[model samples]
Target: MAQVSLRRLVKKYEGDVQAVKGIDLEIADHEFVVLVGPSGCGKSTTLRMIAGLEDITDGEIAIGGVVVNDIPPRDRDIAMVFQNYALYPHMTVFENMAFGLTLRRFPKDEIRRRVDNAARILDIGELLDRKPKALSGGQRQRVAMGRAIVRDPKVFLFDEPLSNLDAKLRVQMRTEIKKVHQTVKTTTVYVTHDQVEAMTLADRVVVMNNGIIEQVGPPQELYHNPTTKFVAGFIGSPAMNFIPARLENGAGALRLHLPEGIVLPVPPERTKRYAPHAGQEVLFGLRPEHLTEEKPTDKANIATFQVRPEVIEPMGMETLVHFWLQGTEVSARLDPAVPAEVGRPLTLAADMNRMHLIDPRTERVL
Candidate 1:
């Protein structure tokens, strides 16, 4: 296992369109890092650059402490798993996994040992004699991964390896991949547009937008303490609710004045931090789970408000209640046992301690 580094890495196409802006990243040895973002965000380009498939327009890339900007992919000591499960049609799983070793002219015993070990690691020993056409989607993906594992390269690159699988299979394969990582402890760099996948598999997540990185941190850190509005809105499911509000100095304490006469006092701990932004128009941010059905609690900073539900969605364990505040729509999570319906006024509590205040002018969390 080895560390990877990118310094001032850049990728540009014709007409001066920059796919990846100059960015610097240091990936530790044996660390699993994920590059996540929307389409056209330069994630795939960055991955290909690291894999030596795409040339760097400028800047440098180093693998295992050696610069590899000019080295061909085959000599980069990296294995890549693509989305399409690029397996040989006529070759059996064993042959496919052993092909790389065979090309490198390894001893027959070494080839057999490596292939067998990889198959065991991937739990596909029984399918070794089967061809790609005879295997399921998940099985075929495992074969691809086994092929990579048999090489024992310095780094592993996965480009949306689960995109083609069904939802259930995707979840199952996620566990399988995590298990493989735990067992092998290879340095891994995975790229995908799915935030959940990034959060599930990454030790550190690099969130990219508009050809530049917006944030890089652990999953929960980015979720709870986003530095920018883009990171705040992109990292969560059902997304965080953003409402236009005016931050007011209510005598001695700080308060947020929302639409329709809904006002919530800021947590006492945050009053000092938000003091400078007082009397400014800021965006009030809260996740759906934090704004929930009113319940008895000993927790401080709980504020209550009433809103008429505009749309109600029953999601088995939790019901998603959506209401319109002026023109902005907001969502809240409630227990499924709570009776809910459209056009009914429901009381909900906002956990001020979990709230976020964002500057509307710069779109940065304040």
Candidate 2:
């Protein structure tokens, strides 16, 4: 196992298009760090630079305390798993897993021992005689992983390896991959655009935007305490609701002025934090789960409001209520026991203690 470090790393194209801005990051030994962002956000470029697949325009990359700026990919002591499941059609599972060892000309008995061990760990011993054409997608993916496992490299890199499977298979493979990581405990760097995958698999998730690192933290930390409006909207499942509101001083207290002459009071704990911008417009953020049908027990930090839902979707366990708030659409997750009807008013409670206030001009959390 090894720790990877990137200091002021940069990647620029021929047209002067900067893919990755100068970013510094550290990955500890045996840590599972995930680089997550949308396409064109430079996540893949950063992974490629670490894998020695792309040339760095500036700065340095070190693995296990050694600088590898001029090293070739084969000499990096890393194994990569791709989304396409790069396997040979003519080679059997045993041959595919043992090919790397065969190239190094290990003894026949040693090659058999390594391949057998990896096959047993992956539970693919029964499929050793079968070729890639005869195996299922999930089985082929496991074979690809087994090939990497046999190499016993210092680092493991995954480039969206679960993108090709069906939804059910993707979930199953996710659990399998987690189990493999726990057993092997090798340093891993994963890149994916799916936020759910990043949240579930990563020890620390790095949120990137426009070739820049926005935030890096544990999954729950980013979800509950986002530093920017982009992260507040990106990490959650249904995403956070953003409503335009102005802060005002009301009866020696701070309150938010919403549309339709509605006012919501700020909690006492947050009064000192938001008192400086009493007369300025700010974006109010609240998660869908925080808006519920049940009344909050803490009356001091909860506010009840009534609105007619524009749409109602009934999920198995919970219902989703959609309504308009000052021309902006907002969604609320409510109990299925409470009947939600379209064009009919329903009372909902907002937990003010968990709310977020963001600056409208800079889009930064306040």
All candidates: TM-score: 0.99, 0.96
Q: Clash number for every model? A: 0, 0
Flag regions of model 2 displaced more than 4 Å.
Answer: 296-300
User: Which residue pairs in candidate 2 collide?
Assistant: none
Tens digits of per-residue lDDT, candidate 2, 1-366, equal 999999999999999999999988999999999898888999999999999999999989999999999999878888888899999889999999888888878899998898888888899999999999999999999999998888888999998989999999999988888888999999999998889999999999999888888899988999999999998999988899999999998888999987767688899889899999999999999999988885648466788788889999999799999999779998999989998899998988888988999998999999
Give the TM-score comparing model 1 with the true structure, all chains together.
0.99
Q: Model 1 lDDT vs. the true structure?
A: 0.95
Worst 10 residues of 2 by lDDT: 294-303
Write candidate 1's Cα lDDT for 119-160 as tens digits.
988889999999999999999999999999999999999999
Best by lDDT: 1
